[model samples]
Structure formats: C-alpha cells, structure tokens
Target: MKLFYSPFHTFVHKVLVTAHECGHWERLTRVATFPFKNNQGEDCGDTYDISAINPLDKVPTLVTDTGQPVFGSQAICEYLDATSRARRMYPAPGPKRWDALSRLSLCDTIFESTVQMVMEQWKPQDQWNMGLFTWLWPKFNAGLDSLERGAERGWDDFDVGHASMLHAISYLGFRAEFYEAKDPVYPHYNWREGRPALAAWFDTAIQRPSVASHYNQPFTSDSSAEACQAAVRECIALRAAHGQ
Candidate 1:
C-alpha cells in the first residue's frame, strides 16, 4: 500500500499518526506529496495522476495494491482499519461504533472550518472577507464547546473516535495560539485534569515513532520570528482587503 500525503497538513498528520499507531506503517510505503506551499516556496503535489483517480485533486490520497483509490482522511483511516487485522482502531458494529463515527464526524466538521479560516487569512487584505470569519468562528467555537462537554464525560479511555477528537484539539493548540487562549473558557476546561489514563494515552501516542516523525521541521527554513511576522503580514493584508 502507498500512503500519499503532505506532512504540512494537520489532517494528513492525524491519518498518518493513526496508521502508525495501528501498526500498519511497516507494510505501507510513505509517499511524500506537496499539496500546500508557503510564500517561501514549499511545494506539494500528488504522486498518482489525481485527475484519473480522484475527481478532486487532493493530498493524502491512498492507493491500494489493487488500484483502489481512497480519498479524505476519515475515509482513508476507515479503510486502513478495515484492511488491517491488527487490533481494530474503530470498535465493532454497535453503539460504540456509532459513537466513534459521531466523534469522527465532529472532527471533520471542525477541521473543515479551521481550514476555511486559514484560507480566509491567506488571501490579500483587499480580497479578505470578515463575513466568512464571522460566520465560521462561532461554528468553530460551538464545535469546540461540544467536544469540551464530551471530554468532560471522560475521554480517558478514548476509543478511535475520541482519539481523533483529541488529536484535532491538540493540533489546533500546536498550530494556533488563538485557539489555545480560548481553551480556558471552553466547556470542559479541565478535561485533561485528573485523567491520567487519557494523559498517558496522549503522551504515548504523540511520542510514537510515526507520530513523532510527523513533527518534521516546518516547510520553511525561516526562523520562528520570521514565520510569525509573515503570518501577521498575511493576516493584516487579508483584513485590509476586506476593510475589516
């Protein structure tokens, strides 16, 4: 199996991390593709002819040995879980499976909103649209709040579903301080507290060789300060374009 992905993407990272945790990394060939690039010239593309296989040109598209194509992180993850005989990532069919599916759906929704937010800020200021942010931020917060409430119910024994949510939340923190700042007021503010089981689980997952490998240096060799400045400039330019 060939797993084609762009390391710069958090969604792709999530899938890769899960695959690694499920013990399928060894049987898989990692194909690095560039789907997102920065001003500094980081390029991402697809390995297979995307148009022929996937109607939508996207990264993280997996091609099985039988010439089957699977797209989307969630779908690909499900495929990985189904094709592997190792311990199942998702629970067997029943309430547990539904529960996991629901959480996975939530992860997809929140991640989609987050990506839109990033794109909204990537454009020139004159082309920016505050309305988009206005519309999405509240939805994003609502999703986070929902996750917080779910976490409060005890995600320590997080099945595959809950694990995906945790990864999404942590990825937001790792990528954006804005979300981190808002986490204090989030519904389950102390979700990580008194949850040694979950904490240990996350600790182990994050440090796994596959997961750790995803933390490769940023696409750009620019200094941290420079990156921040560039991001700020982009945001400001975007806002200015939108007259926000």
Candidate 2:
C-alpha cells in the first residue's frame, strides 16, 4: 500500500497512528506529498500532484495493494482498522461506538478549523479575516471544553477518538510554535490551561507505540516528487493488472 501525505511530523497524524495500531505501518510505502506547495505556487511544479488517483488531490490518500484509492482521513483510518493485523481502533456498535464517533467528529472539526485559521494567518495582518477568527474562537473554546469533559470521564481503551484528539491537540500547539505571528484572539493561547484532565490524557497517550512511532520523528524516507510519482505509476499498473 502507498500513503501520499504531507510529511509534517511536528503534529500527530491520526492516520499514521491508526496504521501503526492496525499493524500496517511497516507494510505502507510512505510518499511525502505537499499539496499546499501547489496552492502557494512555490515552484514545486507538478511533482506533488496525485490528482490522477484522487480527484481532490488531497493528502493522506491511501492506495491499497489492489490499487483502490481511499481519500478522506477518516475513511483511510477506518480502512486500516477494518483490515487490522493487530489491535482495532474502532469499537463494535454500541454506546461506546457512538461516543467514540462523536469524539472523532468533534476533534476532526477542530483540526480542520485550526487548519483554516493557519491558512488565514498566512496573509498579512491587515488582510487577515477577523470575522473568521471571531467566529471560530468560541467554537474552539467550546470544543476543547467538551474534550476536557470527555477526558475527565476517560475510557477503558485507546480508540479512534483518542487518536483524533491527539491529532487535533498536537496541531493546536504546533500552530502556536511554528508561526511568527500570534493568533489575534489568543496570542499566547495555552490549551493546557484549566484543562488539566485533557492535558494529562494527552501526555500519557503520546507514549503509546502508535503515537510514538511517527510523532516528533523526521521523515527519513525518499521525499522527492519523482519517488512519489513512481509509486503512483506502480499503483496505476496494479490497478490495470487487477482490472480495477
């Protein structure tokens, strides 16, 4: 299988965690893809494009051994869980499943909204959308509060929801540290403030083998577009051979 995704290890990736938890990490061929470079017109040319397999040309796209393409992160993670050789990230249908899915939905929204905020900050201060920040800040606060409550309640085992929470929370910190400009609404925002339970849960969760596998680690594999394209071609051939 081939996974085309942005090689940003500063933040946790739920897909990577799910892959490791499902025991499919070693079997995956990681292809570093930066879809943002294309949007930024960063002179990367067409090297990072994977639109052939994925119409959206988004990252975290997985091409299975049978050459089937899975795009959305949730879909890819669930795919990994469904085909697990080790532990499962999803629980069977029940109240536990519903709670896990609810958390997953909430955390994923936070992660995407945070990405939107990051993108808006890419513009000059004068051009930044204050309304976007205003609209989103309250949502973020409420969402984090919800997560804190959930964390206080805790769970019996690590699930897809916890992986997503790590993904969202780590990126929240990364945005603060990585950018030079401060967020207008929460310049020195600290998510851990008054959210001790959530912070505690995060601290312990990061130690899991799934999270530790790629968190804070540098991408040492081939990151060139040529390598990524080569893998894409291989998948295309596989698809043709399988008549898919």
Candidate 3:
C-alpha cells in the first residue's frame, strides 16, 4: 500500500496514527506529495501531481495493496479501522461511535480551517483576509472549549476523535509558533491558555505509541516530487494490472 501525503511531520497526522494503530504502518510505503506547491503556479510544473490516481490530487491519499485508491483522511481512517489488523480506532455503532464521529468532525474542521488561515496568511499582509481571521477565531475558540469539556469528562480509551484532536491541536500550535503572520484578532494566540484539561490530555495523548511513531519526527526517506510521481505510477500500473 502507498500512502501519498504531505511530508510535513511537524504535527501529528490523524491518518498516520490510524494506520499505525490499525497495524498497517509497516505495510505502507509513504510517498511525499506537494499538491499545494503544484497549485502555486503551472510554470512551477506538476511534478508532484497525483491526479492520475486521485481526481482531487490531494494529499493523505492511500492506495490499497490491491490498488484501490482511498482519499480523504476520514475515509482512509475508516478504511484502516474496518480492515484493522490490530485495534480499531472507530467504535462499533453506538452512542460512543456517534460521539467519536462528532468530535472527529469538529477537530477535522478546526484542522482544515486552520490550514485555510495559514494559506491566506501566505499572501502579502495587505492582502490578508482580515474578515476570515475574524470569522474563524470565534469558531476556533468555541471548538477548543468544546474539546476541553470533552477532555474533562475523559474517555475509556483512545479513539478516532483523540487522534483528530492531536492532529488539530498540534497543527494549531505549529501555525502560531512557526508561521510569521500574526492573526489580526489574536496575534499572540495560545491554545493552551485557559484550556488546562485539553492541554493535559494533549500531553498524555502525544505519548501514545501510534502518535509517537510519526509526530514531530522528520521524514527520513526519499521525499522528492519524482519519488511521489513514481509511487503514483506504480499504483496506476497495479490497478491496470488488476483490471480495476
């Protein structure tokens, strides 16, 4: 199986945690892709493009050993859980399942919206979308608060929602610490501030073997665009060979 994704390991990736927890980590061949770089401009070339395998040409795309492509973090995570060789991240259908899914939805939104803010900040400061930051900050505040409440109540075990929470919070921290642009509303934003329960939960969660395996760890293998395209071609050939 090939897992084509962004090489950035500055934050925990929910798909990676799911794969590791589900015992598919060793079975996967990680492929570094930079779809956003490709989108910057056509003159920059499409060397990183994986549109041949994935229509959206996005990262976090997983090609199964049988050559079936699964995109979207949530879909890929669910697939991993369904075929889990070890443990399942998703709970069986029940209230626990619904709650986990709900939290997953919430944190994934935070992660995606935070990505949007990062992209918007990439533009000239004058061109930065103040309105976007204004609109999103309140949602971010509310979302973290919701997570805090959940953390305070606690869970019996680590689940998909916990993985997503790691993904969202880690990236949120990364943006504030690494990105140069200052948010208009909360220039010195600190997610940890006043969210003691969430912070404690995050500290403990990061130590989990699944999250520890990739979080904050540098990608050591070949991460070039050429390598990414090669992996994409391999998946295409595999699918063709199987007449899929």
* Per-model TM against the reference: 0.67, 0.96, 0.96
The lDDT, on a scale of 0 to 1, for candidate 3 is 0.89
What C-alpha lDDT values do all the predictions have?
0.59, 0.90, 0.89
Q: Is candidate 1 or candidate 3 better by TM-score?
A: 3
Candidate 1 runs further than 4 Å off? 9-12, 37-49, 177-210, 216-244
Off by over 4 Å in 3: 39-43
Please tell me which model should have the higher TM-score, number 1 or number 2: 2
Which rank order by lDDT, best down to worst? 2, 3, 1
Residues 160-189 of candidate 1 have per-residue lDDT tens digits of: 675476566665554464343322224233
**Lowest-lDDT window of 10 residues in candidate 3?**
176-185
Q: Model 2, range 1-244, lDDT digits (tens) per residue?
A: 9999998999999999999999998999899998877645556778788998999989889999999999999999989999999999999999999988988998999999999989888888899989998998899899999989988988789999988999999999888886525788888888999999999999999999888898999999999888888888988999998999
Candidate 3 C-alpha lDDT tens digits along 1-244: 8999986788999999999999998998899888877856667587788988889888889999889999999999999999999998988899999999998999999999999998888899899878998898899899999888988998888999989999999998888776734777877888999999999999998999898898888899998877887898899999998899
Candidate 1: give the clashing pairs. Answer: 34-44, 34-45, 35-44, 125-237, 125-238, 125-241, 126-241
